[model samples]
Target: MLVEVGASARLFGGLEQLRQRIEVEATAMGVECIAWAPTGTAALALVRAGVPDGFASPLPCILDKLPLETITAVASHQGTLQRLGCRTLGDVRKLPRGGLSRRFDKELLTRLDQAYGLRPEVYEWVQLPETFSARLEFQFRVEHAPALMFGARRLLLQMSSWLAARHMGVTSFTLRWWHDVMRAKTAGTGGELTVGTAEPTQSVDHLSRLLNEHLAKVELQAPAGDIELIAARTIPIQQESKSLLPDTIRQGEATWLVLERVQARIGKAEVVRPLLAEDHRPEWMQRWPGAEEPRPRSAPDPCQLPVPDWIFEEPLRLAERDHRPIYQGPLVMLLGPDRVEGGWWHRVGEGADAQQTNVQRDYWVAQSQHAGRLWIYQQRLANDETGWFLHGRYA
Candidate 1:
């Protein structure tokens, strides 16, 4: 992987920064050895000769530093070059190019031309695909999900490289395992599990941790013969300017990763967001399970007054006293009645009759002698029977 970074040095700030970036990415991908030089041939020769960071050295010195075996094309002529008093690439370059081309192979001249930058070098750049799907076959069957971690780790490292090459991040991915059919007890051939994140991420550690949590709960029906990872949902990630302080977006992403990991470990349904419903009934005003971002509800009109901080699941019935409700002691009505009447269509459903499906309430914010601030409502009935109930409390 000889990359010509001369033109791209400015894009990465400088040559040193670009080299560091490459080293960091290479380390993350588990690459043990890396070397660079001013030219492609020089870089390849330096790496072959176990040299590192030879880019700053003179061309003659760089060429002479490599062993004779490093140049495969000229290795056969090493004895001939030594008899001609040529001990290094510098000595060979001093020979007549026309005579060298005729006496030796054309490859020797081509190698010298490429190393000295006299000829142009070309490379085919690797491009990332639209989707990611990688599979790994194990030597032995994995009896449980936990045992697949080693293979999964290898796939994850590849995924990280893929994501880096594409400059993208994944929000969701699926891991599928094939069962050993010959020794299988399960009805199906294999099983699959999908994990999603609240935010897009390219971090290998974060994704690995989430996968570990999900695999811990998997009940394998049979030994898995192979495992495959697929990244189905991905989003383009823009590079942001660095800042000295911690970024808010990054912090939010970290929090969401933790939240999604917990959800993956337990169940997706266990995590929820509150949603405001259209119903006017206090208990039916809000529901759970909504979008990641909670939609803010419009404030009630000032004339209608404010709702309590806490609302009971079912309004508590109150004792009557002189046609008014009596809670702990005598209740004081601090606010006027805010009428809410609806639910007429509920009784019109199939197999339904016009019963008590309708509602007509006179809601009020009141102060009880012992219960503190409370939200009480008086039920307006058709049979001329009215009752008071405590609906909520305010701190």
Candidate 2:
């Protein structure tokens, strides 16, 4: 593959860097020979000759000494040219162009002109499709979803290159597999899973980890013989600007990335985060939502008083003694009531399962010699009934 890197060298950190990167990746893909030169034909000749870098010498100087066999077109007519006393490209160059153009095939003159950087060369560059979906067929059927990652990773690397070429990033992608022909009929044909990221990304490691986490929980019914990966969604990514000043501080991964991995490892519903609400009542002031769920894009709700170390799922009704809430012993009210009175429309459930959720309570910071600190509230129930309850505690 001949790449015209003149316009893209800077985007890849310079020519040397891009060359090294391509070589490393190509080597890993079992490509044994790669070359870099000033011209496409020269590069191809270098690759054919196993010369890694031929840019050290001048273009003319390098081509002058290269044997006639370096170019395929020239190699085929070597015998005829040698009988005419032509050995090196320089020997053929010394001959009159008019005579050579008239005596030899057009391909011979064109290739020599291309190699010497005199004539323009054309190549059919890689054309990316509107959508990307790659598949891999396994030599041995994979019985576990997790076991398909080895081949899946190869597809991911290809996707990464594709993304880079397009200057884009992926937010979500799907992995699907087909069952072997020998599998039971009841096992069905295949299955698929879509992995999502909190932010647009092209990091193969991060993507692989998330996919692995989700696949680890999958139970395969039939042996998978082929796997496919599809880029479900993509967005263009802005190129990072180079700083004029040196960077000193390193940054860490975003919080959502860590949470995303955890959510994939555990069930999405099992991983929850606290979302503060607009209500004032203790329990009604917040809700627990899964990490994948969307919530308000703001800071936690503000509170004048200090929050307790722990809040019970359900408030505990405490015994009252002499009109005061009691725990192990009589409670002492250290702070006055922080009244929270509005929750009339917070009703949940339906029909017979419906329960009263409206609350008018006088909350207090109480103390007990036996228990360190307690958050106690007095509920003003219907029919003017009053009851004491413990809401939370501080260690």
Candidate 3:
């Protein structure tokens, strides 16, 4: 493609930076050969002539440098031009324009004019679509999920171009594969696999790696006939601001991408974060399989009461000696008797003879000579029975 970057050089910072950016983008899209020139026609001619950065000077020698195919559009005039001793485009331009226009169509002179920067070059700009969906059909049926990687890579390259053109990033996408008609009875119509990113990304390598991890675990039911990739979700992405020091945003994005790959390889449910709950019972204070961001809970004034560092799943029953709970030796209470009650809702609709479901406890932070620091609670029962239990311990 012949792109006119002269007008956009300043927009992209400068000519060198613009060239570098274009080359980077083309590489990302898997484009191999790329050439640059001062004019659109010269760029195409240079690429066709196997030249790199073939900038056409305003001299007549540039005409000899270009291939004959560069002027193939005017093949009918080649003989007449040769008879006139015109060996190059500069030679043709040296001829009288009025006679040249009369001998050939106006397009010939127009092309020559545009190539030498005499006329303005204009072209329609391509726009990206709002959604992306691409499909590929293989000549042979794919028997395994991993075999679809080649076709998937092509679709990913197209997606990379689309994302770059739109200046957006994809967060989630789906890949669906269809089975051969002959194997439809065993494999059904097809199967679908969905992958999501922790953060929006336009990196083709990152997406491809994540897909590879997911496909490695997928077992195909039957031979696949075709594969399709669809972008299920996307988000706007801004160009990151340049910095002198290390970029924390990029570092965080890298970490998220690693986590995403690990999750794809294993299972999403296996990765989790802790969420704080509104409850007084230490065991029920936090919930697993939670949001990415941990929810913070308000802390009570330390001077008012001391909270245990650890809480056991099931409190251990303790023996008492001389009205004091014993664990290897008599326990010395260091902190308060903080009262915690209520569980009556569990027995609200039952009869009065029903067993009490409520709990009333006075918690205390105690220190035992042999047990070190311990969290003990005294449970009060309706039948006038009371018991002491070791609920937690501190290092």
Candidate 4:
């Protein structure tokens, strides 16, 4: 926790911003105390003395005011030191170095020198675990699912910090809870569900939102006494740095992420997005897939003309008279007969849901005096039932 930020404070938006960011992350990880000083020992003493910011004053000037008992090495010899009229670290410093060295262990002098930045301090780095799993015991058994968010939030904060420390992103995680001992056996221990994201993320807010949505739909089988969260899988993500320029425009997230969130709130099947198809025919050119489904890549528009504003579910058969299509009245051809001939190799739906699969037609940009401009097509099939139909309309 003793970080050297002096070299990179400006890179992180100056000292004030750097401090705020550190404090926010530390608080999220449940750190109770924090302090800043030039030396590690000085910072440690300041934190133990409840001084949140040790940088506001000169190093020795502040460390001198702290009680002798703040440092463990000094505290062990506190009674002896106090009897010798030493009440503070400054008082200890005034004692004869020869007499103090003889009276106390070497640790006392070492700690004193380290506190004043006269000696160097070495840090013991912590090794992070390979996987993350945490458990929280509820003081009162939770009967309602929504009541579990408070505990769930804490676990998520810890997980986020772990993910950041390890430089990884979580793709999926499982939330499982244990029921009270009084619950019936048939109801089981408790219910559990796995929450998955479309992409790897270490965003606690996004995870919390998904968890809240899923929890609302869950009917607790029994009173829950405790809950646990296990990260199923993780992937290393490239952390992008924010641009320092003020005029840089921020980019938005992919559309698929929005679709996935909506799918989480509602049912997956209930959410469908239009994806491009390989066919040339307008109706067969798009497919409705579930929101969670990955959208297949498509080629860019080849034609220069703009497409119609709307296409009917099924081509609306139009009444023909005088060898021309009629919607409300006689139609006037605004644009030419653009030939569309494809889909012979494909078969559409079956039964009542069947559709026109083979499209052999001459399309036109037509207008009716009463109905406005329309996209109509003349069936080129030789069958007697072949006629003109309205395919779409332009706004």
Name the candidate that leads on lDDT.
2
Candidate 4's C-alpha lDDT? 0.85
Model 1, span 1-395: residue lDDT tens: 76778898998999899999988867765567888877788778778878887757677677875666667777779999989988777788888988998999888988878877888777788766888999988999899888888788778888877887898888888899998877645447888988787777788989999999989998888888999999989999886787899776533545566677778777777877776677777755767872355466674333366788888888899998899898989999999698888887755445544454578899998998898989999996558989999988998
Highest TM-score, which number? Answer: 2
Q: Which pairs clash (backbone N, Cα, C closer than 3 Å) in model 3?
A: none
Ordered list by TM-score, greatest first: 2, 3, 1, 4
> What lDDT, from 0 to 1, does candidate 2 have?
0.86
Worst 10 residues of 4 by lDDT: 298-307
In candidate 4, which residue ranges exceed 4 Å CA deviation? 1-8, 55-69, 75-105, 134-142, 162-168, 176-193, 223-231, 239-245, 249-260, 291-307, 319-356, 367-369, 380-385
RMSD of 1: 4.4
Best-to-worst order by lDDT is 2, 4, 1, 3
> Model 3 reaches what TM-score against the true structure?
0.80
Per-model TM values vs. the true structure: 0.79, 0.81, 0.80, 0.76
For candidate 3, the lDDT comes to 0.78
lDDT of 2 at 365: 88
Note the Cα lDDT for every prediction shown.
Answer: 0.81, 0.86, 0.78, 0.85
Tens digits of per-residue lDDT, candidate 3, 148-265, equal: 9988987898897788788889999999999988885756899999888877788888999999999999999999989999999999999776778976543355566777777887
